[model samples]
Target: MILPEQFDQNELFVLTSLLIFYSLLFWLPNRFPLSLIILMMISSATVARLTDHLLSGSKMNLYSIMDLDKYELFDFFTYLLYAPFGYFLVYGYDKFKLQGISVLLYILVWALGATAFGEISLLFGVFKYKEWEASYSFTYYFIMISLMLLVYRFFKRSYKLHKVEIYNR
Candidate 1:
């Protein structure tokens, strides 16, 4: 078990490859079916666990927060919130309703909305995690939200192109 600090080149490569593979797989699949998306999510989670174990020599518990006891209820609720955000974005885009800068603004709004909701819930004692510092929180939200938006855009474009090709054929 390599600790997080002990990630060697091989482990790093494996993790990086898995990330890229999952991202591409999720991004290229048309329809954005919930079942397929869930499968991809599970695969990514499994890979994350494996990477943690390989680096730390122990099973990684998703329930464990960086600085809090397991808040199973809130954790589940948060996942619920996140799922809809992803679903709606893809749905809107696929329907050709959302486009250009509007789509981007929507993504940013949703990201900030989710972050605010999470922070408020934490403040209200619904969950226990360290409050994110302003800079770190912004950066984290930017990366996560951008990743999801990019994947959705990729899938949307691919689906459109595939549809065009099929019609032409």
Candidate 2:
């Protein structure tokens, strides 16, 4: 059984925010195809969550677990908040169709967005940094966002390269 003390304001805020965002996403017409948007959300969330755990929870031990106490249910749920942001990232990238210096600028913008959110999270008691720094997060965001873009590109390319007849489905 879980204790009530485990769930706090930060976790609640994250959950409420995610719920509202998801509700909007479901009730509204999205910029990307429904399936593509869903795929990006899932892919980005999975990778971000996994990497976060490995970096902060295990390898670096940058911050204390969860609510600076233990790794509880609320902590895990908070990570889900990233899924919508991930969708937005992909959506922005796809909409721009950027190239040359524009692509570089776009990636930098997204990384800075991530950093801004990180700062907000810190202010909200979401994270407690130890050895980790903002520069580390910027680098991580740049690499992770770049990888996500590559994955999206590969997904698009594969579909184009292997077009199937309508009857094949």
Candidate 3:
């Protein structure tokens, strides 16, 4: 997809910030289901589109294929787009049953896998980017993954400390 020539730094910042924020939300509360996160992502995207329309006074073009009407295909792909990765994250965490440092490594592996898949999708034109370089994809993913690891470690440590206090009681 061809991006607009005029760059809006504020909008770009908001989009990137939201993506990272949501990524961290998904990473936390390890027991939280992926479906919930996917739902939140969809809702957020819809709200973003609506906000764009209100700001631009025009409806956002969803997607198109060739000259024929093919919005459904686009919508379907978008809906299912993150399911596999989300599933993999949850499943991998459970299957490996990691704890402590192992959890951090598991999250890193999942993040790398997700980033590779995202790059592949972008390369094949399955999705498009705006105001983002190809290399930025890796960078963004790395940041989110590192943030997830940090947050997870913080919570895990807190829980352990709480458990110790309870045991002392």
Highest lDDT among the candidates is held by which one? 2
Q: What is the per-residue lDDT of model 1 for residues 9-28, given as tens digits with 9 covering 90 to 100?
A: 43343344346544654565
Worst 10 residues of 2 by lDDT: 160-169
Poorest 10 consecutive residues of model 3 by lDDT?
A: 64-73
- Residue runs of model 1 more than 4 Å from their true location after superposition: 1-77, 157-169
The number of clashing residue pairs in each candidate reads: 3, 0, 0
Model 3 bad stretches (over 4 Å):
1-72, 139-169
Which portions of model 2 show Cα errors greater than 4 Å?
A: 1-7, 31-35, 164-169
Give residue 88's error in model 1 in angstroms: 2.4
Supply the global lDDT for candidate 3.
Answer: 0.45
Please give, for residues 12-54, the per-residue lDDT of candidate 3 as tens digits: 4334434654576566544433443344345434543343234
lDDT agreement with native, every candidate: 0.47, 0.72, 0.45
Candidate 2 per-residue lDDT, tens place, 74-94, comes to 666666777877777766676
